[model samples]
Every structure is written in C-alpha cells, then in structure tokens.
Target: MTAHERLHTRAWVLHPDIKSDEDRRAAKPALDEAVALAAALPDLEVIGANIVPLPRAQPGLLFGSGKIAELKQTFSENKIELVLVDGPVTPVQQRNLEREWKVKLLDRTGLILEIFSDRAATREGVLQVEMAALSYQRTRLVRAWTHLERQRGGLGFVGGPGETQIEADRRAIDTQLVRLRRQLDKVIKTRGLHRAARAKVPYPIVALVGYTNAGKSTLFNRLTGAEVMAKDMLFATLDPTMRRVQLPDGPEVILSDTVGFVSDLPTELVAAFRATLEEVLGADLIVHVRDISHPETAAQAAEVDSILSSLGVEQDRPQIEVWNKLDRLPEEERTALLARAERGAGVFAISALTGEGLELLLQEIAVQLRGARHEAQLHLKFEDGRKRAWLFDQDVVREETQTEDGFDLTVLWTARQAAQFAAL
Candidate 1:
C-alpha cells in the first residue's frame, strides 16, 4: 500500500547529546535534523522532537531509568507510535526501550537504511541496501525479513503488525548476506564494464554534489532539461543520473547529478554510499552546491569537503562552488552573496529556479573543459564486434557507415578513452 492510503505513523524524534571529548555537533540542530529526517517519509507524522542530554550511555536502556520513565510518560501523553533516536542504539537498548515505552523504535542507521530501501530504484542500489540491512540485522537478530529469494522492494526494516521472532537465526542472515554479496559483485562487474566503455566518450563529466536538499537536482534539470526529481525533500535524488548537453558556445559534455551527501552517516550504511562515491571519484570536475540560505550551510560544506577528502579527491582537483537557492535568500543578502561570488574565482551564485547567474556558470564550465576532448574517426573490421560494442557503449559514435570490408565511425572522445579503446 502507498503511504497516503494508510494512517500516518505518529512519531517522536530525539537527538542524544552524550558527553564527548571532541567533534560533536550542537544538540539543537541535531534534533532539528532528526525531525527533518522523519519528515522525509510520507507515512511519518512527527509530533514531538527534543535533544536528550546524557553524561554517558546506559548499557541496557541507553537512557537512565529516571529519564526513560519521564520520556515514557511524554510518549504516552503524545501517543507516540514510533521513537527515532538520532544515534546508535544497541540491540539490548533497542529491545528494552521499545518495551519500556510501548512504541516502535529505529536508531539513526536503521532509519536511514529504511529510507534507502524505500527509494533505491536500480538493481545495484536495491542489492546494496538489502545487504546493508542484513548486516544491520546481524546484530539485532530480531524479527527480520529478507528479499534474497524475491527481487522486490523494501528491506522490511519498518516494524508493523504480524512480525515474527525466530530466535537463534544468525545462520539465515549470514547465508542471505553471502547470496547478496554474490549478486552485488555481479552487478558491480557489469557496472565496471559500462564505466570503462562510457569512458571512451570524450565528454568530460561535470558532477554536481552537495548536502541533501541543496537544489542539485533542480540545477541539473534546468541545465539538461531532464525530468529528474527536484523536490524540497531530503535524499529526493537517490540514483546518479547522467545527461548529455550541448553547450551553447562550447563543446558537449556529460552532466551527472549524484546522490546528495548526509552528515554523521553511520558505519553500517557505508556500503550504500559506494555508488555515490564512485561517481564523484570519476568526475573530471566536481561542482559543490550549497544552499546559501541555510543557517548551517558552513557545516554542510565542511562535511562535503571532508567526504571528498576521504574519497582522495586532491585539493588541487578541478572544482567549482555554486551558492544555490539564491532565490530563497532575502534581496539584500542575495545581492551581497552575488557580489561575493563575483569576487571569488570559480564561484557562482545561482538560483536554479529563476535562471539567475547560470549563464556565467555555464560559461565557466565551458572554459574549464575547453580543449579536453577531440573528434576522431576510425575503421574496424566486421569481426571486431567487441570493439564496436565498446565504442557504441561509450556513446561517442556520432556517425557510422557500413563499408565493403569493415565499418567506418566518427567519435568524439578524450585522449585517455582513446588509449583505453586502443588497448582493447
């Protein structure tokens, strides 16, 4: 059933501010983020949210007994059906808390995994989410469901009526994970082959990446005229979408809109990010989009930079900074931001909705990628089906002709792609 048909799930959000030595975000914003995450799902109706301050975590219940009782009263008063903790919750803690509060519960990682399961469209995406869900289930071993035998949607992380509880079932989870690994391996190999073949296209890939709800998809749709989802929702753009665009005054290039990055991602969902990082790592130019109007835009940008650093994208790599959502800013601030953008090299303030400052951004892109690829023509024997297929897979063949002894084709490709094709 669709989310709209069912009664909305009343939920509460909490951010645990445990005592920490270093590197902790402000509790209030973290609570706000947790609430927003809950709001992302159509079926979730978040009625209450707060930052729960703790000196240290409890081994059994995650919260102190007093605090748990107090929160239980609050949950009962608010009729909270689900409790979303914006941090890790051990299996014991989860089970205890659920019973104590008489409500369903999802830790930070589990909630994100559920979101991924709901949104994953591609085969590889679905498999990755399922594998991550299984890995997550390995710890809980509670009533869990898997799609190992059926290629269906959802990982069944969300608990509801008629859930089963099969004790001592670690073996089932391990076996499912093995099968999922094999399936994912096959998908990845096929993906690798596609990427290798796609590299032959001389178009330098310009990738747009930023924090969720940063307007990357809006900008991508504006530039490419592709019908990519550009909602104001978090993680609205899940799959990496690529489109070819012919620049008005420059060579054609590939514009790729990748999955939006999230902050404080849990280790359990690391495999789910593989597809996103793969796209970013392969980009010739990275466009870091920022919602300049957001209060925590600086923190969001820092997280993006940190993730890129972890991906080994060097500091000297070609990049552009786009201060997006300028239309959402006040007139005075937008003007000031525009002025600042003009002063900074490779920075553009644009409102993708209104087409403000995009001309300059496009021109800058053209300048950056100028002379990056060349037009070439080649002739291959009829027996060279693999080479022909590889070239076609690259989407570089602009023209082709059948000849007496072979085939003639025209292509536009980068020198590196040409070398790889030659090696093939």
Candidate 2:
C-alpha cells in the first residue's frame, strides 16, 4: 500500500435496521447519514456503506453469526480498518465485533464525540467533549484506556489511545472524570459570570437552532458578517458563538449561533452540553433554521423539537421557522413551499446560500423580536437614579415629571424589555 493511502484509515459504515426497534428510520436514508458521518472524519477514507437488515439484534454479536461472517469477508476484501455503526452498540458487542471483523469499531455516540472533539474551537468546548468522551469510554468494561499521550485533542479512540491495550481500571477513570468535572465547573462559572454581565446590557438574545448542516451558520454569517466556519458538513459548528447586531426594523439583539443538534444525540453529550445549551433557555426568541430540501427534513425537524424539549426549552418561548435551502428545491416544490410559508404565521422560506427571500425573513425577524408593546406608569425614588437612567436610556420613557421625592414616569415597552428593566 502507498504511504499516502495508509495515512487515511480505510473505513465502512453500517446502519443496522432492527425490525423490532420502534424508532428505526428509513434504512436507505439512515445509511446515507452514516456515510456522511464517515465523510466528516478527515483521516478516515470511506470505501463503502450498507444497511444490515435484521429481525432483531443478536445479543452477543449484534448480528447473526452468518451475517457477521459475511461482513468479515467483505471488510477483509475491502481492506476496511474501521467500521462506524449508526446506532448504539453494547460494549460486549463492540469488543466481539472488533475481534471478529479484525477492525476497530465506533458506535454512533463515539463517532459524534469524535466530530465534536475535532471541531471544538474553544476551551469550554474542548473540556465538555473530553468529559463526555471519558464518560462514554467508562461504559465499555473491556475497552482499553491510554491515559498518557493525550495531546492529540481527540477521545483517543481512533488509533491514538486505542494503540495501547490495558485492563479496565474503573478507579483511574473515575479520578480523571473528577478532574475533568472540576475544570468544566470552573469554565462554566466563568461563562455564568459573563452571562450575568450581559444581563445588564439590555439587548435581547436571539438564538438560532436546528438539525446539523441546516444552514444556520450560513444565515448567521449573512446576518452578522462574522467569518465563522460555515460548511456543508454535519456537526460543522460545535461551540456556541454570539455577536451583537442591529436589525433592519427590529431592536438590536445579541444573536447566538449554537451547536447543531442531531437525532438520538448521545446522553453523555446532552448532559455535558446542558450548560452550553442553557444559553438557549435565556433567549427571548429562537430562530429554527432548516434544510428544506433534505429528504428527511420533517424527521429532522421532529428530532430538533424533541431535543429542544429535552433541554427544557418551553413551548411558550417565541419562535420563528426559517425553511432554508430554497434554492435546492425544484421550481414547483419551491412555489408550493413558498405559498405554504406565506400561509403560516412566523414561517419563512429562504435560501441562505443565495440570499433569496432573506430580506423578508429578516423583516419578519425584526417584527417578531419587536414583540408587543404596552404602556406602564411607575414612580422612582431619589436614590434610584441608576434605575431611572436605565429606563430613559432604553428609549421607552414617553413622559417624565419631577417630584419632591423622586420622579413619575410613563413608559411604553414590550414584555421582554419590561423583564430586563425588572432585572435591573
């Protein structure tokens, strides 16, 4: 084999479609998604992928003996060194499969963690990925942990940590876990301090969330003009990025671009990123960007909704739906979708790539974020000069009269602004 060929690990993707599994997706699309995940790994060369149909998962090997043998031959023929399973694999199954197929293997959770670790650009993001990866590895009773030489910045699963084989030492892993948690807590506390400081800035937060590769970063770049890495790949953005921008007709807001979500996200990641996602909870409004042209757009949207609910995002939060990627749709389909979006309130069909229909979408964002305004009267004491000044600075005060003790003011503001004022 050529040295260049050996540089990349030859890999294959397998999506097991168990008939008894209630949540199984369409086999072909699932296979496609698995292949896309393989392509996301730069050091992995994907030779092929398949959907292995099964009546039910076999306990010991995850597949029937005959099926396993058939796959072993195929992997040997293709010189496949790694296999990425599109669903959760039991620790025993993972170990047995590696032995049978004579190839390293990673399940859905491990693969996602790898992508996250690779894309993590911030200290907080890196710490969260490491903590999640450690927790995931601890579950594999027979799996080896390479404690040293961790400078590679990944979970040490592919080739790095897996190079050294050792007996499972739960106590060492626990100690490392404790250390990671301590570092993560320190980072989160600093983030909390920053968020608290932002609370005094008076600008509402608008968060953009959706399934992976859903053009959220594209829209964010177009709106904010920041040079964020916007790409046509899953898990492209792993860290939360925020910038302040003034809308065309809306109030100036803090726009946040968050990590894209995926179906059946690993529980460890959900827990680890909970603090990162907490920023979403404080958002006054959410913009749901979607790849309208994707075959599984509906299913992806459902998954995003489920994750949002799991993250404690309430239904009462104000939200707008941006059906992105309109340019990829057929003319007939695009026309029909445009009509549908027009008929639906708070929904806009746009192409963030081509800048088509973005104007109206931005206008709607301004409208939705403006919220409803109402009038209120309040009296402030002489000692509350800061609070009185804040009200005037927001431009919400319509009238003010000086009194002996303090001032009487009449103000018109939205509920969001009112809440910010109360916080002050």
Candidate 3:
C-alpha cells in the first residue's frame, strides 16, 4: 500500500495537571496546535480526545483505570490503529500504553519528528532530521530493538541471537549517527564560510521568524520577490532561503526566511537545527511576523521570543514586530492595532498577502538599518593600497582626500563591520 493509504491514526490531548482555570487556559494553545497538526495529516482521523487529570504519583500511564477503559472502548469504536498523544511519554509508559490499547502510540516529540521527516526536502534537512530521530530513538532503544530477536537464523551465534541482534542494531545506529553528525558538521562549516564571505560584502541580514503559518514565507516572497514555498500548512518551509532585497532608501539587504517556530517544538529537532538557526544569531535584525488576526498572537510571540532566547539571539539585537494579515481583521480593530503600532510600539501592522502597509514597514526597516550604520574617518598610509581597496570593497566611501603622507577616507558601515575594519 502507498504511504498515504497506509497512514491512519487518532489523536488526543491528555494534560495531567491542568488544575486551575488559568492552567487550562494556558494549555488551550497546545491543544489547538495538536489538533491543527492532526488535521494536517493526510490519512489521520481524530475520532476521540481526552484530558486526563492524573496525579504525579500515577504519572506513568497518565490515566486511571476507569479512564483507560473508556479510552479503550472509544478506540475500538472508532477503529483507531494508532494513538497520537499531545504530550511526551516515557519509553516504558509508551510501551505499556500500546500493549494495553493494542495500537501504536506516538508522543508529541515522535509526532513532530514524523511530520519533519515527511516535510524534509533538501539533503541537509533530511540529514538533520535523521540525526534528531536517531537521537530521540536512542533513549527508547529497548522498545525499538526488542523485536530484532525475531530475525531468521543466518549464522551460528556464540551469544543469544536476540542479544546479538540488539547489540548490532545499536552499533549500526551509533555508526550512522556519527556519520550524520560529521556530514552536518561539514555543512555547518561550509555555511560558516559563506557567512564570513557575506560579512565581507556586509549586506545587512534580516531574518524572518515567527510561529508556523504566520505568513513568514509569504512576506519573504513579497519583500524579496522570490517564489519560495509559502503554504497554509504547518512547517511549510524547512530550509532557510535568502534573497537580496532593496529597501525604500535604495540600500540593499539580504532577507532570510527561516523555519517557523511552533509551540512545544521538539527539543531534539531544535538541537539538530542549530546550524540553520545560526543565521538568526548573525542577523542584523529579526522581523517577527505575527498573524495579528489569530487569537493566540501574544502567546505565539512569547514562544518565538523564548526560542530566540534559547538560540542566544537575545543579546541586544534589534527586532521589528510585524503584525501581519491585517486584512483578516475588522476595520476598527485593524485601525486600533495600527494606532498602537504607530505609538512607537516596535510593531507594524501589515498584510503580507495583500501588500497593505508594507511600504511603511519597509521604510521602518530602512530606518533601523540606517541607524545601524556607522561612519568612520580613517587615515591610511599612502603605501597601504591594499587596505584602501579593502575598505572600498567593505563599505561605501563617502569622501576621500589624498594627503602628503596618507589618504583620509570616510566610510559607512555597520558596527560589526566597523570592528572588522578596526582589526584591519
């Protein structure tokens, strides 16, 4: 059977300690993200959902006997071949739950990993996802390798066949993991070299980052006029795409579209994608695109901020909040948002799909970039022709005068570039 044809599953939300109304309210976004993910699965059907409020002492199964019985009956009635949990599950707990329910059980991490595996297109992306999957699977090796014992007899074994098979699988995975890491390291080094070259040219890097489906790719295409894959689906763009964009002031900058951050993103995937995310760390500015019409905009913004902080991108870098999709909002609400944005709120209300208020946003970005530029007057010895040529290539020289023993040049550059020039 085809992959889509064989794909069938049911999903549910189970929060163990949503004690207060506030806690439940906070969990609603996670539940929404889970439901959205399940709906995105081509062959999956969400036939049942349950919010189990089990105590910590009995956290293993995440449900009481009564609740388990109810879930089993519902699964049987709905013909659910797999169970997708909205939270992480311990390896033992996952095995036990699958045995009791007589179906496959995948926790939140596994589900996200599966989606990433399916969405990965480029070789780099595939390698990163494979590394993450292996890392995650290593912790659940017992459950994963238990079935290796059923292999047919092929050779005389001094050790038990099952033990040998398990050891072999573990060793193979370890070897593969090492190879993948090496490949990724090479890719990262190549990227670093490219970044260094770009720095020499010194085009301001503006990275677009936000929650999934917040129109980041759409805005990226709109700004850069590059047709990247922009869809309503979750995690549409896995690989980072960069294009040169001319600002309103006629200054050019490199705009990058990064992978969208989601609530409760798998830690393994995050760790794996660090190389890709390094772009954010090196950015001159970050454009945080938010779906202003979405009810969870603030929370989504918080999640993005948390991820940025974790990636070490929170060190005094400028961030512009672009409240996008204003076309979806009512006129009065949109006006209110715009008014708030106008009051020096570090936010811009725009519609990436419709190009509404984009000119103003571009002008704002240009203003920030202009502010980031620093002009320096340096006296270079006349014999230092190479340094003069490098400075001309590094930045735009506004003025230059030949002196008796030296040449005085005035150059405009970003602070980082200024440091590099000073080092020279």
Q: Compare the candidates by TM-score and give the number of the best one.
A: 2
lDDT of each: 0.84, 0.86, 0.79
Report residue 357 deviation for candidate 1 (angstroms): 1.3
Model 3 superposed RMSD (Cα): 6.0
Candidate 3 runs further than 4 Å off: 1-25, 48-50, 57-59, 142-162, 371-413, 416-424
| lDDT tens per residue, model 3, 312-349 | 77546888999999999988998898889898567888
Candidate 1's C-alpha runs over 4 A off are: 1-6, 142-168, 374-424
Write down the TM-score of every candidate. 0.81, 0.83, 0.81
| Candidate 1: pairs in clash | 202-413, 202-414
- In the range 232-282, model 1's lDDT, one tens digit per residue, is 878877788889989779889889998888897877666566665687776
lDDT of model number 1:
0.84
lDDT of 2 by residue, 73-106 (tens): 9999999999999999988788889999999999
Ranking by TM-score: 2, 1, 3
Instruction: Give the Cα-based TM-score of candidate 1 against the true structure.
Output: 0.81
Q: How displaced is residue 107 in candidate 3, in Å? A: 0.5
Arrange candidates by lDDT, descending: 2, 1, 3
For TM-score, candidate 1 versus 3, the one ahead is 1
